[model samples]
Target: SELSEIHSALKEIEELESDNAGAEAPKNLAGAIKVQVDRVIRAYRTLLGMSGHAQEVLEVGENPDEEWKNVWLLLRRDLQKSMPRGSELEKAWHEAFNVDAEVAFEAALEVRDLAALMLVGVRYPFAPAALRATKASADLAFAEGQRALAAKGYSALMALEPFQSVSRQDLALAAIKGYLCTRELGWRKAEGEFKSWIDANPAAAVLWGEERKPIGALLLDFEKAIPSFDTLELQLGESLVSMPMATLAGQPSKAEPKNLETQAWPSLKIKGPLSPRTSYAMKNLLEVEVSPVIPTVTPTSILVNTGEALYGFDFLSGKSLWGDGVRLEAPRDAFHYSEQDPNLILTAARWQDLVIAPLENPLSKSTDAPKAKSSFGGSVFSHFPVVRRALVGVDQASGNILWTLGGQYRLRSDQASLPDLEKRIAVTSFFTLTVVDDVIYALGTTRENESQLHLVAIDPAQGKPMWSVLLGAGQGESNMFGNPMRDAMPGIPVVAEGVLYVQSNLGAVMAVEIASQRVLWVSRYEALPRPFTRIRSTAYRKVTHANGAPILTRDKKGNLLLIVAPTDSRFITAFDAESGEVRWRTQTENAQ
Candidate 1:
């Protein structure tokens, strides 16, 4: 009955296409046809939701109904040709995942849906080694003297293999190219293809000589064939741990013994010194400020924070690719150092398909009476309003804002609340968002009284809050006349080994277990009196200046060390990463 109903809808669309033979397709009529197609898609999606579909997804031996299979094939064909991209249609397309993984993959490939094919590949248990079958098929073709067809098959199979099989697949591709080289005209084509491969995989390409190599040699230690981690000249800031790219690509890394003394201070070539006034101010500011530059590199791109914006740059050219592209306002001062630093204000975490970052201004703010103060209480950007922040998800390809998490921040309820600095501080808490294991850890504070810190966990895939844990009270209330706690530099939150290390301006270092959503250990370094006033008769209040991100690294013995350096203090403490036991403590001057 449902099959007939779907066919009837399909017939209606065919009739509409016939009617539009000469003139343009009418918009209203097209809309009506879309409604019918959507009905069939919804029905198919509903069937996919049924428990029967679960058998087709998880149990390979159990066959799906032949009638249902044919029904889906017809629906898929129609949808692939006419269905506009929409959430419902996408959901329906995703439902094509089946127990028969090979068939499912072919269906997706036929539709040119790479995303859907990837989804099916992940869901299919045998898809990782699906290349083995293709390899065997190509071998048969090659043995039968079908050189052209076999070469084409080998190229297609190379495209399908996972990264782990990359070495083996490259060898397979080399063999096919070798076969092409034996022919007179095909030698040029083979040379061109080899050059292309060499460009893409220079390290892997080096193993092969200018002439073709035996296919067997192509499998020569893929691990060693890959480039070493040292190839990337990543500029990780002082007190940072770097991960080797090869290790992340599933290659085992040998732990090289490092001399801590020599590694501590990198050789420096100073251009010159700042002016006396500026130098003095910088020294004092450096004591309380921690400028962290977290760099993430992909094969094609490099991402870095320049204090003003999160930038994606072309890997080879070092030219700017795409920026967060969020501009606050026109700078009043010639320096352009306004309420928004605009240089390194945004931090980002890269996931599978999204670049999640802290949305500095979570909500739209009023532009009428714009006013922003610099660290020295001087007007940096003239007439620029204070921009508060929240978490925003950006599309990796287009660098567009896909979704935003966290509440919108409006400094003033109306024009009258414009001067309320307390509300401004509450709405804007220093946050460092880091992505690990497909989850985004948002370490910051909500715009609330008492200025309590909020650590939120978000699912980057759907841009939804998974869980949240409240930490220590923020650097306390704002002091208008005295040293404002908001201006105090915040320690960046670092995520490593499934734990988040965050230090607030209040001088508290917390190790939070991300999965458990609980504090592992809290190390409070120091605290000072709040309101920052000297009143012998009044009650004593204290505040902290521990606002920089903690650094995590492994020592020579392979024991993980969590380094906590408080911005206010000259001392840095090292703790055992797993047990939270104090390993060592050293003064910043002595250590550096």
Candidate 2:
């Protein structure tokens, strides 16, 4: 029956090839035939070992009734003679099959090998089928370890083309799983490959698109996958690439980094329905040297800074109740001022230095001055008395300065001349001051130097330094000037529960025990490894408001608002304070 089937298959192949003589025949047919004959020969050899003479008779080329041995030898010789001398069939048989079968099968395959290929396909259809079957079996093995098996299956499928839609779907799923499971195989590579394949087969978009959504979602699951700076770069690059020809007609071909930087740091425009109108001004103009203090008290009074003195106004009615416009001699351009209490204002007067003026009566009119100067102990009343820097303080009536403080401290000149003065004190310049309780903080740089930051605690009552901490070592006057002003520290020191929270410009956040002058805890901000230029170039603005407790805002690289809680384990939280809490989270971004 097997012999008859082989004969029938041979006839069918012969007729098919004959009909396709004008067309290209299947290319691998000869190799396929050799594979089949090799298997049959092995089986015969095994059978001969089991049944001796009987198998030998069956193996002969001729009938047993007609000298089968001679006939068999003759048939084998003829087959060998018919084979092509130098072909793939000859090489395959030689490498893969036994020597005897190699010679015989090579001969048989070369003779248009219909019988051999068909016989092999029928008997051991399993050679290639087994490979396909093993692949399915391996996929099932994933039941034990889904990720590992899925990865292996994906690799295998990626090397071959799928014959069916189901097969393609399976392969795609495996690829997605593999990408998700292996960190070594990053999402970028996987996405790239997927995209490339989709591009090659545009029609597969429907199938691939369905798969892409999940893969994309999986990629997004990795919090640190795509950096914000990189995203920005891509966005900018795309925008540039997509620019209309008309738009670029007169412009330069390339955009400079400076141009991008300038465009990026635009001053925020306060506009919209919620924005305060420009015509709106607090009533009762009072001049204080410091930034205004907004009191939390009902019918709150906001203290305003007038050129020389401090004044308080009722926030509701915007009415100024009282102000002492006392013209005291302040440091040259003595804008250095602050209000400790709505009634008590501290101003750094020009030549005489510091002065603390106290208003005698509230809601009382008349240019009557108090009888004696309120004693903060020292004749010098302002915490900052440096010649070039302003002063900061809180007004007597409102306690709003608890969060915001500003003043400048200048190093005075020994010589009468301005140039000589700049040389003597190394002229460190501080333009802003912050006072917490009795401690006063100054943020500024020296003349012809980098910005300098100094934390000085003073007896507000006596105008004396309790303690002073210099942020950086001063690189004094140089013939060739460098920016002596270092970056301002990330956030101001939050003084709460007798402890101070300080964040360094270098991203180091430290908690200091004020009394002991000891660092309680230290934490570093999560930032990309980049040069300080990228960091310093970013915009930062401090935000202050009472949220559960007093929360201080420090912009991290101009992209994130770090809301640091000084009293609560020094927890530095984040929120999109400008847009509300909707998009409050920290994400990494590449630095340009």
Per-candidate alpha-carbon RMSD to the true structure? 21.9, 27.6
* Tens-digit lDDT track of model 1 for 158-197: 5444322445545546543433422311233554564455
For TM-score, the strongest prediction is 1
Residue 390 deviation, candidate 2, in Å?
3.1
lDDT score, candidate 2: 0.34
Residue 352 error, candidate 2, Å: 26
TM-score: model 1 vs. ground truth: 0.42
lDDT (0 to 1) per candidate: 0.48, 0.34
Off by more than 4 A, model 2: 1-300, 304-311, 321-388, 392-410, 413-451, 472-486, 504-506, 520-522, 526-585, 588-592
